[model samples]
Target: MRILIVEDNALLAQGLSAMLEALGNEVLGVAGDAESFVTAVLADRPDVAVVDVRLPPSFTDEGVRAALHARELLPGLPVLVLSQYVEDTYARELIADGTGVGYLLKDRVARVDDFLDALHRVAAGGTALDPEVVRQLLATRSDPLTRLSRLSRLTEREREVLALMAQGYGNVEIADRLVVTERAVHKHVGNIFLKLDLPPEDSGDRRVLAVLTHLGAPRRTARDGRDGRG
Candidate 1:
C-alpha cells in the first residue's frame, strides 16, 4: 500500500513511517500540520492516509478536516484517523462520510500488528473503529439502525463475514480469508444486509457506514433477531 502520514509529532511520524515502510508499503510523506498534510495529499496521492486527529496551530480537528477534504478531493482515498486522546465527534463525522475510514486511539499504535491490520482494512475500503468510539456511538443509538442491527441470525461463518464487513473488508478479500469464492461471499454479504433491514443505497464500500452504525448500536442477539448481542 502507498501510505501517507499526516501528523505533527515528529517522533511519532518518523516511527510510523519506518514501521509501515518496513512492512513493505510505500511511505509517501509525513507532514507537520494540516496545510502540509493537504499538500502531501495532493502531491503524493497515497492510496490511504494515516492522519492525526489533532495537528499544530490549534491541536484540534485540523486532521479531521483535512481527512474529510481529502475524501472529497480524492474519492476512494481511504483515511485512518488516530488520536492520543479519546473523542467521538470525529468518529461520528467520519462514519457519516460513509465507510473506508478508520478511527483509532494512539495507544493502538503500541499494538503494531493490530494497527497495521486496521490500516490495510481501511485502505481496502473497510471501516475500523476504536472500541471506545464504538461505545460512544452506541450511546446515541438510533432506533431504526439499532433494530436492524439485531436482525443478523447469522451462522458462525456468516457472523465472521458480518464482523469483517463491519471492519471494512471487501467480498473478495473476505472470501479469500474464509477460503471461499468471491461469488459466495457476495451472496452472504447480500443476505447479511437484507437481514439487517438496510435499504440498498450506494451498494459500494460506503456500505460500511450502515454496518458501523448498526454494530455500534446496542448489542443484538443473533438468534432472537428482536432483542438486543452484537
Candidate 2:
C-alpha cells in the first residue's frame, strides 16, 4: 500500500516512515503540517493517509481539518488518525462517514502488528477505531432517555457484542475474545442489527452502522455470561 504521513514531530514521522517501509509498504512522503499534508495528498493520492491529530501553526486540530478537507477533495479517501490522547469530537467527526477511516491513540503504534492491521483495514475501506474512543463515545450521552430508548431492545449479550463491534473487531475475533463460537457470535451480531433496526442492505455497511448506533447510546456494562451459550 502507498501511504502518506502527516505529523509535525520529526522523529516520530521518521520512525513511522521507516516502520512502514520495512513492512514493504511504499511511504510516499511525510508532511510536517496541514498545508504540506494537503499538498501531498493532492500530489500523491496515496492509498492511505496516516495523520497526527496535532500539527504545526495551531497544534490544535490542524490535522483533523486537513484530513476532512482531503476527503472533500477526494471522497472516500482512507485516513488513519493518530492522537496522543483520545479526542472525542475529532473521533466522532472522522467516523461519522463510516468508511475508510481509523482513529487510534499514538501509544498503539508501539504494537506494530496492531497498528499495521488498522492501517490495512482503513486502506480497505473498513473502520478501525480505538477501544478507548469507543468507550468515550458510548459514555458520552446528552439525553439519558434517548439513549435508553435506542438501546433498550438490546439484550445484555447483544450489547457486549455491539461494544466489541464498535472497537472494529470481526466476528471471529469477537468470538475468541468472548469465548463463544463463531456461529454464536454471528447470531449475536444479527440480533444486534435487528434490534437496532439496521437491516441488511445492498448499499452501506451494516457493521459500521451498528457501531455508530452503539456509540450513540449510553454505556451499559454487559453481565458476565461468557461461560453461557451465546
Highest TM-score: which candidate? 2
Query: 172-225 in candidate 2: lDDT tens per residue?
Result: 888999999989988887787776676643122346644575556222122421
Provide C-alpha RMSD values for all models, in order: 8.2, 8.4
lDDT per residue for candidate 1 within 72-139, as digits (tens), equals 67766789999887676677677766557898999998898889888987887777877666555545
Q: Give me the displacement of residue 62 in model 1, in angstroms.
A: 0.7
Poorest 10 consecutive residues by lDDT, candidate 2: 221-230
Q: What's the TM-score of each model vs. the native?
A: 0.70, 0.86
Which residue pairs in candidate 2 have backbone atoms (N, alpha carbon, C) closer than 3 angstroms, thus clashing?
Answer: none
